[model samples]
Target chain A: MHASDDGPHGHHHEHDHSELSDTALRVRALESVLVEKGYVEPDALDAIIETYETRIGPRNGARVVAKAWADPAFRDGLRRDATAAIASLGFGGRQGEHMVAVENTPEEHNLVVCTLCSCYPWPVLGLPPVWYKSAAYRSRAVIDPRGVLADFGVTLPEGTRLRVWDSTAEIRYLVLPMRPAGTEGWSEEALADLVTRDSMIGTGLARAPGGVAA
Target chain B: MKPLNAMTAALEPVAPLPRCAEEPVFREPWEASAFAMTVALHQRGLFTWSEWAECLGEAIRAAQAEGDPDLGDTYYRHWLLALETMVARKGVAGAALLAQRQAAWDRAAHATPHGQPILLENDPLFTRGA
Candidate 1:
């Protein structure tokens, strides 16, 4: 985070007021204008930011994956209709209105990309990271899933078929990574901890129970 | 690791995705603000996702035409443009009003001292008349 006083203008001694980057100034200006014009409410803006910042994130999706792994019935439900299954667990809205849960198995791996743009399952995974939205990832994921995975340092077994799902405006995807070994009889909370965001996105695998940080 | 083809190799050094513990989803505070503003406007029924998508698509295309490279950094910049364009097209706020407000903010931000909030009232040209 840039400190209040440290910025592009930090070296200048002639000015009394701090300088902000043009982009930052523009955003602040736009918000002020919108608030003053009554097009938006200041409180509402804060509420929305607060929601994404805290209440909604990959943690919500981790719990869903954990429940699916621990309970057969929930796993079936997810396979049948992921949107409702995920919503039933209280994580659905906005970008996640339509959902598909693709499972990763020893025989096949599932990867996701949005070739047209960065359409992602925000309800499940939170906002996409920089790389997921990069042109390299979007264009190359479908054409070269194995290579993309390799870039992420994930190497699949020989002959493991890879399926790449291109996210669209109508549908979003969440990869249900296979449960790791040695987690037998573990509580859902502990299981959820093993569900990394990358695993759920199919860029990496679920952390081994023993590999989890202490 | 399998060797990448020429195309993938040209786009080498793909930045690693930030781990959940490594960084926040939003890199900058303004990016979050821009994202929240768009979602808030959508929730208010000012526009639909499809509409937002179209506007964003157009913005991205325009940026690309000007050699944007379509890398990830400018994604939110396009998003903000889309939001502004959508708001203007919908008549929620006119272009002139937005421009005026932008100028006001620029002034206010400059007038604010370090560590102080940049309030619209601080804009040197600000008056309650409008």
Candidate 2:
């Protein structure tokens, strides 16, 4: 939040730096102090970062999507009860406790937003992207979802119904993007690799089969 | 279930965090870190949850007065402010240190190009000059 020219003290002079109150700097400072004071462990921070960056993010959701695509039973399970189906795969907690899985079909498109806050299914997805919480994304997604999708380089068929999910804390939403074509016989892992985080958020479509990985 | 928190009523936010909510959704890594620190401090008995709620409520109210729309987008930011409040009050760190660190980061961020991490030349603790 600290732009060079604007701050509480309004010290925006060039080539001068003695103090700053930007969020980044404040967080770093807080972290160092917490660590030095023995309130937090540096190694704990490392592990948390590693988990979010790799082990526990969109990949978890992708696996769920790919499994649903590969197994009719799993798909049915997810449709019947998203919370249970998602939990079966070990991605259940906190922001993800309540999930409603909306699928994209030939006749309909889906998008997710929390105009009130950045409510999302965190277990299946990792941390939300910076843009997701921006006022622009939060506001426009509810008003002009198709336009928002277009900004993400996604364009839908004219007649496809665009369904926007306004996620609340109790009931978060996740888009189950349609499995792309040309992947008939592809393993779940291969299909999972194609599920981009944006697709799950309903901002963009999943990568087409044999297409680029997000 | 824990009793519903009264702070939610005081804040009167359009989209309030669910009472007794275990965790709020995080949209960025820094957001999560900011969140983790607060929880850690509270868990260690640095402050009570009610106190946290009061501090956070006040921060949000202050931001609203400063022309924040009170949209949920600024929720974590309020959380950050509350954290600053607690850390300063509890003597975990001084406000000056935070300000100094923020300045250093601002300079580093300004010098660095987009999409690159901002690196502070000296750790804020060691930099007595600032």
Candidate 3:
């Protein structure tokens, strides 16, 4: 990833990475005022941020996906009721009270979006990337799924159909990508390494064998 | 990869706010702060939920009028706009002061790289409060 390219997990790079979204700066500005007025405690703020930032993130969902790939019974359970299956793994609360997992197969691809707002499954997938929240992505996601995927450098086969799910506050969707080939004997831990944040969002394909997911 | 620790500090706190079953997911640390600030301001009796809704609705309408396509992900932007306008209108803060802070943060954010936090103390222009 580039040091400052705009995408999901766009902030991740191998450098200083001090750049931030405009919303971040605006929030900082507001926080200065709130802190000055004593309306919020600095320590409390840090705890919530740390919870989502480090304690809970993509790894939570990655474990679920890896388990599905390794266990057929678990995959069936996930498809039957993703909420319980995910929560059974101990990753549920806040924005993930309701969860629906969409599987990607050879015949169809699934994409998730919040046409009215950014309704994401935060319990499983960490925070959304900047691009996913952009006006461009929001507008084009429902209207042009193929084009949006292309922008992310993803091209599906000609016969593959695209299914786009619009997220709401009550319900959220996650894309369960197809397990990559040549990973038959790999452990769940190794398989989880191939699952990226974008793959679960349907903007990217799972990493190929010996390929970098990020 | 860029170290996210520098860009966003962590935070925690939950408040009882009006919600029609709101899921309340934040895309970034700042988003959570923004949401908390809105609830905190309301708890302080600064404004009614109705008034906040009106301001947010008006802000969203204004953006749409300005050619924002109404795709919905930028709801927080409108929320920020509403918060800024309401705070200034309510006389809690001067409009000019808010404008100045906005500009200062914009400059600070530009100067900082992708992963660093933007603090008011880091900017010389933000010394008025000290």
Best by lDDT: 1
Model 1 Cα lDDT, one tens digit per residue, B5-100:
643554466533322335575778888889998998888888887777778878878988898877777789988888878877987776787777
**What lDDT tens digits, residue by residue, belong to model 2 across residues A1-214?**
3246755897774543344346667787788668767988766766655566557778899999999999999999998899999999989865677798999998998899866546667789876765676556677787777656655556788899998888775788889998887888999999898998878988777888667522
TM-score, cand. 3: 0.62
Docking class of 1: acceptable
DockQ of 1: 0.45
Task: Please state the error at residue B6 of candidate 1 in Å.
Answer: 17
Q: Candidate 3, chain A: TM-score?
A: 0.81
True contacts kept of each: 0.50, 0.20, 0.29
Put down candidate 1 lDDT per residue, A1-214, tens digits, no spaces.
1234546866635356756777887687678777767878888888888888888888988999999999999999999999999999989999999999999889999998887778889999988877787666787797778777877768898989999998887889999998998889999999999998889889988888777421
User: Please, what is the TM-score per model?
Assistant: 0.87, 0.62, 0.62
Best by DockQ: 1
- Put down candidate 3 lDDT per residue, A122-148, tens digits, no spaces: 889876655665566666788778867
Question: Distance (Å) between predicted and true CA of B4, model 3?
Answer: 26
lDDT (0-100) at residue A124 of candidate 1? 90
Model 3 CA lDDT for position A188: 93
Q: DockQ of each candidate's interface versus the true one?
A: 0.45, 0.13, 0.16
**Candidate 1 chain A, poorest ten consecutive residues by summed lDDT:** A1-10
